[model samples]
Target chain A: MIDLKRDGDVFVLRFDAGENRFHPDFIDAVGVALDEVERTEGPGALVTVGTGKFYSNGLDLEWLGANRDRFEEYLRTVNALYARFLSLPVPTVAALNGHAFAGGAMLALAHDFAVMRTDRGYFCLPEVDLGMSFTPGMSALIQARLTAPVAHEAMLTGRRYTAAEAQAAGIVARTAAEDQVLPAALELAASLAPKDGKVVGKIRTDMYAGTLAALRGPVF
Target chain B: MIDLKRDGDVFVLRFDAGENRFHPDFIDAVGVALDEVERTEGPGALVTVGTGKFYSNGLDLEWLGANRDRFEEYLRTVNALYARFLSLPVPTVAALNGHAFAGGAMLALAHDFAVMRTDRGYFCLPEVDLGMSFTPGMSALIQARLTAPVAHEAMLTGRRYTAAEAQAAGIVARTAAEDQVLPAALELAASLAPKDGKVVGKIRTDMYAGTLAALRGPVF
Candidate 1:
């Protein structure tokens, strides 16, 4: 369900599964794709996109219901994925084809930049409405990526923001028509692909040290 | 000198010292003013401003040169001040009449919002250029207040941002002509004065628990 392809200097990772939830197998597939991207010799960047109606709908609740015993372990693996994308050696962009909700929206934030399809889709975090509080790591990641006021409003109110609103709120870097979303991300990624990957990674690592520590620490 | 005056529901704290560097006496005076602000009953808010050409220039290096042994203690006090302002029971706004550099810039970030003079001043963090690094608390504060890209650029490059640029980068909530900075800040503060102070404080404290922990922790 995960397709990793090379387009010039950009590695495009496309999620074809319906609703692209974080199933364990899906996570493993993405991890393997990332391993290959990380090993690119020189001048590389990444773009992640999704098929049709959904970019991603966050965690797989159905799977979690069946595997309740692995809750903590599952969350730990998910948090690690966020940290990895946040500190990836190459520039990365998320091209949102449709809805990005909760953990899915966060996955987009973990990337260096994001481009959303303006005509459709939403970026939302509904934990508050669902009677849940964010883990310390998740909170840190959100606060790290967003400006204070935006973070406060989004987290406390669980607002569903459209692409235009998200861009204005500093949540997404750009917005384009549905068909142009991936192309826009690819263009932006290719432009940044020439930067030294190690330096980019090092700078991001230092810049987000607190976030990395929080994500790598205990979930409680 | 620090001047605290009651203007309707808003308390205006004006810093009159030349350069407004954080000397021990200045710190103590500001602390006293803050105590008064905290004691405010009913609807209340705060607006801080500076005289002449400086909002504040940050650390009192000249004073530090003479009291070398107090470096850690002094920084602790400054950090505490930041924490206090960040978690104040009422809404707060900073009116940047002129330059806000290094620690001073951080002071602005601690406020709920800021309004800066649009002409003849700058907002900067020169630590990278000065061969110094941010303490964990300072870094946390900056990251918390800014979007990731803006934080990355500011912390790494030590760029001097004009008021317009600062506003565009989400550094300040608004910008006004030189003569209107304080008025703009007061207007914003006044508008927010009716919010339940306890609720505001509680939400901010919970939202920034990590930042408060870092600020209240050891400087090293």
Candidate 2:
């Protein structure tokens, strides 16, 4: 279950850790959030969270390891779901309840910003360890956003890091006190609410989506 | 005139500076070179260069200063001209001759790899210094390829550096021998020629253009 709750000027969106992740329905939920943000006229912000200790394992490794055919189906669904979150018009912050591994790590990176527990667990895209690479496109996006050295080390080696290290690597915006993580993220969202959402939104949108728009026409 | 010369297992695409530093027709010549590379049927590679000094200051900055009223017209033409260069379906290398400032800097970045001179000048995008930032889209592309510290400093200060530092910062792939820059670039292109272009092309295309095939319909 995903709930969008309003606390003060902030909109807290909570995602429940379920038996199924990245379902077609979940993808639709993300699109709805983006639409709401784009059409909203008031001052508010959105913070995404997950229930309990898992931000999301999407096609849990155990399940995928045992079910290959199902994994492919899940991948297609996961990719579309992630793309919607990336397309959101407003600034987004992902508050990782605990571990965000593999596809989960990719999800966290797609957000405009993220916060996690420094001591509890780890975050990583160990898909390479599982014998694959980031979709070429997503790999390119990571290359653009992070220093090549960091990107190369993470992808090629499939290393995991505690939340503090993720912050140091410039991926995690900040590490929070276990009790303070969501609150910290909510606070950050609240800060952006007063600022001109249009300007902030424009800058973030241009940062992520504007590049492709400019290249729309046939160059050849 | 731009010329393609072969070295040991490498094909170098050298752009010789003509009448106008980055000859107005230079952009077109680049497009033609790319078209040929595409037809070659392998992981395409090419390196750019200028005759003596300066890879290219890009768009004859001085010319633009005098033609402000017609800048819009000039820009539309240049925009159309560079479109093909940006979208070339091959992995290209920028073998910068000398100074690559403004448009010169952009042209260099469009490549998959680049080598710059260590003797003197380096890259800079001083558009913001010109009392306007007309390349909002370009800014996004550049930021993705560069480090935040480097991107922030370059865009905010408009400072230029020696080629040596540019290479270290990953702005330039590597510095080349004064007279052998073209030879070096050609060498790299040829080396990569034997690799499976299918994979390379698939990777590059996916990176630049995602399933962006239909922007209107539900992405899924």
Candidate 3:
């Protein structure tokens, strides 16, 4: 289930369901959670994190395998999720307590900042290893968020970056031990909570227009 | 004088003028040098370096003060220079061998990578202290190139960042001693020179669409 709770001016959205794959039900729950946060009166920032050893394993491959006919629609749904997080109206942070792979990695990249657990967890985009290639939207998103050499390595090699490595490579803003990831992310979010959300939103929207356009464009 | 020298697949553009301020003649000379680099066949990358105590002191305030009538046109010229550098059809690296202040800082940020001298000199944006505010275009450019918090501090405080501080704050890609800055930058440029220039150019253009639009828009 997707759980959203408010603590002061920050909202924490936790994916409690195991592995947190993008299944239809999981997507619906996250959408509802996001809507609630967006409509709330006092939230200044949002942080997304997951429980257990897997922050997210990305797309629900099992579900997709069973519903091959819905692949296109599923992709569109995933794109919408990424787009929503990318242009969220307030500051957003990804608290990576566990592994983030493939589309899961993209989700972390969507946020303005990321805090990862240093003792464990790996951030990776394993599309090449899986014999898949990034769509234009995904490619644009990666390029927009990462520097040239880092993006090239991440996309081509499917390397699993440790927290220290990711921080050194500029992937994550900071790192914490396993128990501290969420608090660190919340602290970061809370610090920037006073800025006007609409203004921050507009700046982000304008800053990432090209990537947004590509993400929202036709799926085919 | 602006100098363009081809080092195999990398073209090195050196600003030999003292202080390397943006005088009209200096601008024209740099433009001509850039054209030569653009015209040179098979140049896979570009590295911009300078030969004095200042990589560049930004605008020629002395000239601007004397030629008040040319102020508007002069901004356009400066903007053109920045835009050209921003979308150059090859990979670019800025070798900041000495102080890079104001517009000089912006120029370094436009490049794909920057190597700075760690021993002396500074990287600064002193507009706030100078009783000036950034134009929309300049603001957009800084926002595009830097993280929000870092950009906010640099623009608002007009801090003179030491090389170590600049690297830690993500302003410069790497820092070296005064004698090593150019070589480090050249090494970086040369390493990435095998990549297709057109592809790199396209990626940069799309990634910085918002900033480019503002920089190229009406200069009111």
TM-score of every candidate relative to the true structure: 0.61, 0.54, 0.66
Query: Model 2 fnat?
Result: 0.14
Off by over 4 Å in 2: A1-74, A77-145, A148-220, B6-9, B18-20, B61-70, B129-132, B196-202, B209-220
**How do the candidates rank by TM-score, highest first?**
3, 1, 2
Candidate topping TM-score: 3
Residue pairs with colliding backbones in model 3 are none
Task: Please name the candidate that would achieve the greatest lDDT relative to the true structure.
Answer: 1
CA shift of A127, model 3, Å? 11
| The 10-residue segment with the lowest total lDDT in model 2 chain A | A211-220
lDDT string for model 2 (B1-220, tens) is: 7887654434567766652254446666766776676677534455667767777777766676777776756655555444444455444677776788877786676566677777766788787787646444456445645778887887788878678878767687678778767666677656555545444444443443421222111211
Question: Each candidate: how many clashes?
Answer: 0, 6, 0
> Model 1 in CAPRI terms: which quality?
incorrect
Off-target runs (Cα >4 Å) in candidate 1 are B1-149, B152-163, B172-220
Error of 3 at B55 (Å): 0.4
TM-score of chain A of each: 0.99, 0.81, 0.97
Provide per-model DockQ scores. Answer: 0.13, 0.10, 0.06
lDDT per residue, candidate 3, B1-220, as tens digits? 7888888888899998889999899999988988877776663789998887889988889999999999878887887788888887678899999999998898888788789999898999999999977667778888877777889999999999999999888788789988899889889898767655655665566556677888888677
Just chain B of model 2: what TM-score?
A: 0.79
